[model samples]
Target: MTSEDPHRLEAGHLPTPFSADEIRAATPQGRTQVVRTEPLGGAASTRRVRYVEPDAEGVIQVRTSIGEDGEDQDAPVRERVTWRDLQSHASYPADRTSLERARLEHPLGDLDCVRYTMGDGDAVDTVWFDLARPGLPVLLESRRGSDLVLRVTLLSDEVDPG
Candidate 1:
């Protein structure tokens, strides 16, 4: 899907806490993307490529794990999350701790993003949502004190199974 205005998120006003219907409408029915995690401490970096699509039951995720040697390590595993669960996860709490807008650069390219930050002090988590794809997150960052404990990035979503 193409954006009507690529810069809308940077300049225009946006509805905070996107509604479920708005997310459903904005999200593509199917997507195949790579998720990457940065290595922390002595651990190795990891990558997982998964295909997610909608079915009569709800949404299905087919994930294939990649080994540290850069090869598939296991058979694909499938899981389904019901529509009820999707909706519940999509809902925003009545009181949000913090919200902001920013531009993020990812493997998918540059995107205008809306960021939601929760928690305070040493315990904090932040999620950056691509404005073009309302429900999907482009990046998730977790920080402990002054150090970044974990970071997950959505590499790309242009890999179509068809």
Candidate 2:
């Protein structure tokens, strides 16, 4: 599996909310590269993390701003995660999200996907992803009432299923 496969999530992509346990269950054997970006406004900063699990190796590319000019610095950092680590973090579902829409056009303008809305009132989160292609997150928006806290958008994705 390579990141430059030009697969574009294929077709008929849909996403369902994976409970906390489900995410934990999928940690091991499901390794891929994810690229996401957060637009800057708060703290005048943006971050990007690309998780690389090559041959059971846990590597990540961390990018952050530095200095008063907000220049960016990127570095590759590896923090391996084993099956036991994931199992230790697994837990029962605390909250559930319902499917909000289907066949929705992703903001990236390439893939068709689904949306799930979770949380309540002041702490609502909306996530969209392609179940057919589970590499990078599609889009994640978290808001507390009328104020938006964080927004992460997919930049690119390549799945390396080693």
Candidate 3:
């Protein structure tokens, strides 16, 4: 899809305890474009931000990632991918009817799932996608303590790339 398409799903969560700047800097240029910052769900240690980028077939996803401090830990490098890849790799519970309903209602398309190790030596998995509009991306974070899920919609228009 062209970059101008406003109806794209782009959302995901970052592992806890990592630097936002580092993650942003490391994100592939143009492929994943940061949109803006968003409020955290609760007492989460990580930060959230929205983004937009083309998937494998060039479909844009309104994406987000949660970042935490990863300086001293063996956290795997933050994993990122196009929505197309995520959609292909997503695995849902066979008996979870509610989850299946949710998927059908708000499909994440390409921005599906990602797994990474947290600083506390635990694995954090995230699933994200567009629910209603391209600007509004949903994020589901599963960590050690509680499962944190957030739905963030695009709040602003495209930032002039000038």
The per-prediction CA RMSD against the true structure, in angstroms, equals 7.0, 9.9, 13.3
Query: Which residue pairs in candidate 1 collide?
Result: none
Regarding lDDT, does 1 or 2 come out ahead? 1
lDDT string, candidate 3, 98-141, tens digits: 22113322232433322222233353444443332232234444
40-125 per-residue lDDT for model 2 (tens digits): 36453344443444234233333343334434455545455533233222211235555554564655565666566677757887
**Higher-ranked by TM-score: 2 or 3:** 2
Sequence-dependent TM-score of model 3: 0.27
lDDT of each: 0.62, 0.47, 0.33
Tell me the spans in candidate 1 whose CA falls farther than 4 Å from its real position. 1-30, 45-49, 68-70, 87-96
Off by over 4 Å in 3: 1-43, 48-80, 88-90, 100-130, 134-162
TM-score (C-alpha) between model 2 and the true structure: 0.52
Q: Report the CA-based lDDT of candidate 2 relative to the real structure.
A: 0.47
